[model samples]
Target: MELDRSGRVLAALSVAPALAMAGWLMAGLPLLLLGRFAPLPMLLLGVPAAALLCWAGTRQAGKVVEATVWQVAGVVAVAAASAVFNGVMHSEQLIVRRDPATYAQYAAWIAGHGGLPISVQPEAFGGADPWLLFEGVGFYGVDGGVAPQFMPGAPMMFALGHWLGVPFAVPAVLGGLAVLTVAGVVARLAGARWAVLAALTFAVSMPILYTSRTTFSEIPSLILLFGGLALAHDALGRPGWGRGLLAGLVFGLAVLVRVDGLRDVLPVLAFAGLLIAMRRSSRSTGSARPYGALGLPLAAGLVAGAGLGMLAAYLLARPYLSYLSSSVRPLLFICGGVLLLTLAGTAAAPMLSRIRLPRWAPAVGAGLVVLLMAALYVRPWLQTVTRDPVTPEDRRTFAMIESIQRANGMPADGRLLYFENSLHWVIWYVGLPVVVLATIAAAVLVRRLLRDGTPFDWLLPLAVIGWTTVTTLLRPEITPDHPWAARRLVPIVIPGLILLAAYALSRLRTRRWWVTAAAVLVVLVPPAVTSIGTAFTPVERGEAAAVEAMCAELPPDASVLVVERVTGDRFTQLVRGMCDRPAAEVKRAGAETAPEAEVRRLIERVRAAGRVPVVLAAAPGQVAPYGPATHVIALVTRQDERSLVDAPNGTWGLGIDVWMAVAR
Candidate 1:
């Protein structure tokens, strides 16, 4: 029977859900069924799943049902293939780098408690307060409020992992699914071949691979970003307030996933704004659609507000809103306004009509207000909390600026160590240049679209550019640090850059060679450097190896005293290993927190315990102020070995190896 166009579309949509479900089940079943008993099962399952998806997606069906079936199958195939590869190999590395100890502890927590509890785990680590901030032991009963650093999407993802009886690596599998879906959607929007290229590029790209494997919020944030872009793209294809609102909803969800998540909202706002601009620009005389002018912003604001409100509600109920005050409030408000304005302006229209510069005067006023707030609120708050002036010498700021300067090849004393080695942690390893290049490419495409209105042109690049802006700006020098910004931003920038390149390439239809070469240069350089670095010199591997070596030396009865400037992962690992047995690391006759004198007293108590004292890491140039009675045992490297010694005095200088007595 020949189906009508609407009938075909219905048929296509109707069959998609089943195909999607089947594909999902097929992709994850191996991991779930084998339960790490056989990695081969996962590899084997991937082949048929992928083949089925490919076959179904490629098949020609006159009706929408057939087309949709093909789409679902293709998406499933890609996702399943990626999942199998990720589940078998990359997930372990991600887990190790991001939260090796946490996963181990989670296993222990499960064993001890027999299951996860509805409330927070009393003994969980990874956040400030054990009971309030951490809901460890994998997935089930995890409260979104527990991990202030992690977006709710990832943990909610992990919760599914717990439900499915999969390892912590399972979240990476889910992330792969999102990545694959994004590529597929992009491909369909562009072309199937283009989709495959994008997927292949994303898969091989170091930044995407690094994020896809980790349990960090970046992957989930990217998923939300993609979801928003896809929704916004669909909304633009057919304009309706409901579609715009739906776009807003996706954007809101993105922010709830991560504050940087608001970046994806830009295209939604921009596209809407462009519509209004087109409408106004089409008019010959003065307009009375001022209320219409507010439509896009109002929608975006309500959506963003809903997201913020949801997060605030979650935080307030959890007593987290108090984390914001005069100093911090200003930053939040500024970030919120900037995010809102960017989204609104992006959607409002490209015209300089009714909603002119003066109406946006409030944003300028808000900018001044933000600056004043930063000066007044942040300065005093920092002084009070830091108990020192916010100067160049301020350790945290000094270390942060130093790291950035170091990456840029500026002079630094290197005397003070960076917190979490965040300087190297982000720029060097995360490979931010990828997004930066993407930004240039996006700008090129945006300008092209401005000079020439190309349908389907504005959506992807605008979304990406918006996302890139958010990613770049949201980084703040604070306690938690903005470590995930690079990865979270990658999804934004890469797609944006690629879309821009696609546009640029389109422009070079007659003269493809030179333009194509330039486009290739744009895409290749950042990721190439990143790829080379990751392959040749993996920081996570080196760091993990050092930490593993340290953990190996912890004797059943021995206590580890970390000194100097070992990374946070190093200390946290030592604690997890020691805590595995009641008295391995911190269990001693006595304990003390901070203060040199109190620590000295604690050292005496360890002497009383009749156990050998071990110092895990000594920061370069830091002396423990130990009395002469304290003797040096063996020096422990951050890698858990005794071969490396502390730097002597300079930034590279290690600390001393000290024990209360040779014999306790």
Candidate 2:
């Protein structure tokens, strides 16, 4: 089991692809910003940049023994298999109701046009009728443009799939990339041997699988975060400016994928500052060991990455940014305060280092960690977190909760967020054995750090993972559902806990096969089986074909006016983007109803604009009155079910019908 310098270099090669994947994602930002997202140009710049990043991340990796040939190959095989399986079974979430479709459509427009502010094409719709709304769910209608929700980072990566003519393949690759990065971190932090165990445990979990099979931002964010972790671990040892710069860039670029990434990397910001502070302290002052020379570049890269993300948000996706202003404002404030505190800590480093700690402090801290977990479990009995349905979104959330409650036969309380059961959600996904092992590892690691901070590599990662995990467990902010709510845990908690849990298992000095097998079975079985119902069952099949057929029916220059509720909710963007037509959904005359007067007036306007007007509906009867009804889309698929009170067991039936009439 002994390793040499060659082992260290081999470990670097093992993780190099993971870092390159992350770098490629980051590299797309410039192309997207410049509105020149051509494949040739993107690959030309991205390939070499990715290669450079791999070199930077791995150059100093030779300082640590983190992986072996067998271990690396084993982890890679599992990761490759995950990517292929996920690709084969990937969901065709082309219609907009949730995030996946939003991302699909977003990436679609970007790939097709290589620009932002998706044109509303008001000229075809007779100059923006008051009776029409250009936006669909997750797509916002700005002054004269359509904007996609969420950060552009994941979509930027997904755009490659469209450029390559295999859109789902991007998610599959990212899913696999996520696995490799997880293995890399486990290899570096715990030991080289435990990497595959951690990878297997993580790859089979429902959250990882679920996010990977669809276009969720979580997978890309997870990859970037963990890829950065792999780089940062190596940099912490050799303290090269390039290594720290790349690590911090990817870490901060995660914010480009998800806004909450800012919150997640707060510890990184703090750790960078701490490193600078310790670097200034002298041996005469009995200061802790300096972290060589990593802090400044790491801090600079983080700031630069964050600045780029915010700039992209401001320039390209303004409507989405405006909508998230309330949440974004507070996060910005918190970051500012943390930066100020870091500066203060640096100034006071010498004074801070002279302080001493009690030997029993580690034991006390460990006991407190256990106490916190126990308290979270006991919290439901004492507290019920609820908010009044005051805002429009709050009311919608309340209604969704009530419907889910009724479906599950639980008491209907629209106000409940179910934040109290957060830890239980973790159990439902990763199992009790993992939770036990992770808790033990975290507590023991904390104890070791306090007693003697010799396990120096664990410093920044533990700070980052532990902080995000605990904060999220305390207030998940997402709706309480099996996989939907589990998005909060996907990026960090699931993988972080599994890695630590594996590290804990590696500590067991047992030679017995039965003992090892029992441990593996206990830690791995529950999570792998938890998602049994849906892992093999693909959702939203044949949806892309249905959409294509629907799009093909409409002429390239047709102006679509959707008059039905379901049709508008589902096909607004599909018509606008895929059909390459100007599409608008009439504003509701009543509860999810289109006003006949407005619909007819819009039809006249479309005619006046010298374009074929198409009236779209979910039924033959709804569109037949305009002209002769043409059946465009008939889709029958399954969708993931929502649950708040109890865990979701399976999916529900989904049916989509679109009918259109071309008015001459």
lDDT of 1 by residue, 1-664 (tens): 2323332333223223223323333343324323331234434664466456433532332212123434444545656666665555443321222333344333333323222222231222112221111222222222432222222333333434444556456555755656564653454344432343345455545556556554555555555555445444444434455544544544455554444444455445444555555555545345443323433642664365345535533542233333323334654666577657755654444344444344545445435433532343234233322223254335544565456446445575433222223222333322343333333445554444444334443545455554464444334233322223335335465555454344334343455566545555654554445544333222232333443444554554554443333222234332332234211122222222234443354445555655444443333222335422333223322211111111011112122232332212
| Lowest summed lDDT window (length 10), candidate 1 | 640-649
Point to the candidate with the largest lDDT. 2
> TM-score of the candidate numbered 1?
0.53
Model 2 Cα lDDT, one tens digit per residue, 1-664: 4455535654665467556765676677778778777788777988788898787677646356646667767888888999998999899999887789999998999899887778888889788778888888888877658888889988888888898899878898888878888887888777767777788889888888889998999988888788777777777777767878887888888888888889989998998988887787754465456474788889988887777778778877777877778787988899999999999998898888778798799999889878887888788898898878988878888998888889878899998999988888888888999998888988888898888875878888888888989888988887676678988899999998898898888898777888778887998898887877678877888899998888888877699998888778778887888778888899887656687777888889988899989999888888877899988888899888786755556788888888889974
Pairs clashing within candidate 2: none
| Global lDDT of each candidate | 0.40, 0.82
Candidate that would win on TM-score: 2
TM, every model:
0.53, 0.96
Sequence-dependent TM-score of model 2: 0.96
